[model samples]
Target: MEMAPMTKRDKILLYVVLMLSFIVLYIRFLLIPGIENVQQAKADLTEAQDAQTAMQETILMASVNAADKNTTWGDLQNANAVYYSLLSSDELDTLVTGLELNHNMDPVSLSIGEAGTQNLTGYAAGDNAGQTAAPAGSTAAATDADTDAVTADTVGTTAAGNAILQQILAADLIPQYDQASYFRTSDVTFSCSGDDSDFFALLDDLADNYPSVQLQNFSISTRSYAAADGASVTGNVYNVTLRVVLCDKGGVQP
Candidate 1:
C-alpha cells in the first residue's frame, strides 16, 4: 500500500490530540491519587491534634476535681487562724478568748498585753546606780551577786514551767502544735494591787480551768484600794501575772 504524505496542518492537529490525551490520563491516574493522599493526611493530622487536646483537657479537669475534694473552707480558716494569731493582735485576742472559754475561765479582766522587749535601759541604769551607790570593789561584787540570783531564779522558774508544758504536750491536746514551735514564758508579775484572797482565787480559777496544765513557778503581789464611798475596800484590789509555756503534739504541716 502506498503511504499518504502528511501535511504540516495534519501534524499539528495530531500533536494537539496526543497532548490532550496525556493531560487527561495524568489527571485521572497521578493528580487525583496525589490530591487524595494529601487530603487524607490533613484529615488524620487534624483528628490526632483534636484527640491530644481532649486528653489534656481531661487531665486538667481531674486535677481540679482532686483539689476540690481534698480541702474545705472551714479547715482552711482554722489553719490560717493558728499561725496568723502570732502576727495579728485581733486574731490573738480571739485565740485568747477561745482559750479562756475552753478553760471555763472568766474572760473579764484578762488582758493580753503587748509583747515584752529586752530591758536594756533598765539593766544599764541599774548597773550605773549600783556602781555610784557603793564603793568600787564591793559595788561590782554586790551587783554581780544580785544579777546572778535573779538569773538563777528566772531559770529555775522557767525550767519548772517547761517540764509541765512538756507533759501537756505529750498528752497531745493540740494536734498541730508543732506549727507553734516558738514557745516562750516570761516572769510572772502582778498586773494590779488586790487582796491576797482574790489573788489566790484567781490562781485557783486558772488551776481549775486548765487541769491539764500544771501551775508551777507561780507568784503574786498585792496593793490596797479605796471604794467609791471614800472608804478603803481593805485589800480589795489585786494584780496577777502568770507565765505559761506552750507545747504541741505534732500533726499537720501548717
Candidate 2:
C-alpha cells in the first residue's frame, strides 16, 4: 500500500491511544492484585478477632466452673463432718461435764461402757411396725414389760444423741468413727444428788434438752445415816442413779 506523510494531529491521537493502553495494563497487573491482597488481609484480621473473642469466652466459662466445683466440694465436706463420731473418750467426758454444768447438776459417778455390742433386739428402730406377730407363748404382762423397756430405751437413746450434738457444736475439732456392719451403742451410767425441784426439773426436760438420749433407768431416794445411841440423824441425803444409751451413728468396736 502507498502511504501518505504523517500529520502532527494523527501522531498526537496515536500517542494518546498508546498511553491509555499502557495505563489499562498497569491497572490490571499491579493495582488490581494489590487491592485483592488488601481485601484478603482485612478478612483474615476479622477472622482472627473472632477467634480471640471465642477463646476469651471459653476461659471465663472454665473459671466459673472451677469456682462452682470448689463451692460444691466445700459443702460436701461440711456435710460429711456433721455425721462424724465423737473425737475421743476425753472429749466425750468434757461433753458430759458441760451438760451437767448447764443444769447445775453434780453427778457422783459417770461410766461409759463399750460399743459394738451387736445386741440389737427390740430396740431396732422402725422395725416394730413391720414385725410379725409374737409366738403363741407370748403373755400380756411380758408384752407390757417389753413395751415399758422399749420406751425407756428410746428415751435414753434420744438424750444421748442430743448430748453428742451439743458437744460437737461446742468443740472445734472432730474425729471420725469407723463404720461397721452392725449397729453399736454406748451405755452410760451416772448418779446425781439434788433437791426435788432441781431433780424434777431435770426429769421433765431430760429428754427435751437433747433429742438423742434418755434415762434408761433412774432412782431417787433418801439415804439414812448411821444412828448413834442418842444422836439425832436429821440430814436427809438425796441419791439418784441414771443410765443412758448412746446410739452410734458411726459404729465402733471398743
Candidate 3:
C-alpha cells in the first residue's frame, strides 16, 4: 500500500499528545512529590508548635509556685529524719540528764511512754527524797492514817484508768494517723528538784528552747532540804513534776 502524505493537522495532533504525556510525567515524578513534601513539612511544624506551647505553660506554672517551692526548701531544715527518734526512751533520758547536769539539779524522776502506758513514780536516790520523819503525836498519827487510806483508794482508781487508756492507745484504729506527715505525739513524765532560782531557770530552758516539747500538766511543791555538801546547812527546795506531750510535726522519718 502507498504511504499517505504527512499532514500539518496530524503533526499538531501528535505534538499535543506528546505534550500531554510530558505533563503527566512531571506531575507523577516531581510535582506530586513536592506537594507531599510540603504537606509533611506542615505536619512537622504543627507538632513542633504544640510542643513549644506545652513547655511554655509548664514554665509559667512553675514560676507561679516559686515562693511555695522556696518555703518547702526552708522547711526541710526543721523536718525530722528519725522515725519517732525524739519519743524513744533513750533520747528522753539523754535530754533530761543533760538538762539536769547543766543546771545542777537533782532529777527526782523521769519517764518516757507512748500515749497511754502507766508510769511508775520515780524518787530521788536519797531516803529524804521519798519521805521525811513523821511527827510524834497521837493526833498526827491519826491524821496520817486517814490520809494513807485516801491515797490508797486514789492509787487504785488511777491504776484502773491507766489500764484502760493503754488499751485504747495501743490499737491501730486509723492507719493514716501514724504516717510521717502527721505529728507523732507521746507522753513524758518528768520530775526534778531545785531551788526557786534553779526552777525558774529550768522553766526558761524548757519553755523557750526545747523544740517539739509541749507541757501538758505540771505541779510544783516546796520543801526545805539540807545541802548535799553541807550537812547542817539547809536550802529552799522545789519539787517539780510535769507531764508533757512531745510532737514531731516535721514529717521526719527514720
Q: Estimated TM-score per prediction?
A: 0.28, 0.36, 0.39
> What is the alpha-carbon lDDT of model 1 when measured against the actual structure?
0.41
What digit string (tens of lDDT, one per residue) describes model 1 on residues 1-254? 98889999999999999999999999999999999999999999999999999999989899786665354323433322211112234544553455444433333344444533221111122333322111223222221221111121122121122223333333332353432343322323333333455456655654433322223343443334555466654443334444332222122332
User: Candidate 3 on 110-145: residue-level lDDT in tens?
Assistant: 777664322222124322233311111211211121
Every candidate's lDDT: 0.41, 0.46, 0.48
Deviation of model 3 at 228, angstroms: 9.0
Measured with C-alpha atoms, the lDDT of residue 74 in candidate 1 is 32
Model 3's alpha-carbon lDDT is: 0.48
Enumerate residue pairs that collide in model 1. 192-239, 193-223, 193-237, 193-238, 194-237, 194-238
lDDT of 2: 0.46
Lowest-scoring 10 consecutive residues by lDDT in candidate 1?
Answer: 147-156
Better of 1 and 3 by TM-score: 3
- Residue 212 displacement in candidate 3 (angstroms): 3.7
Off by over 4 Å in 1: 1-73, 76-112, 115-198, 207-218, 228-237, 242-254
* lDDT for residue 182 in candidate 1, whole number 0-100: 32
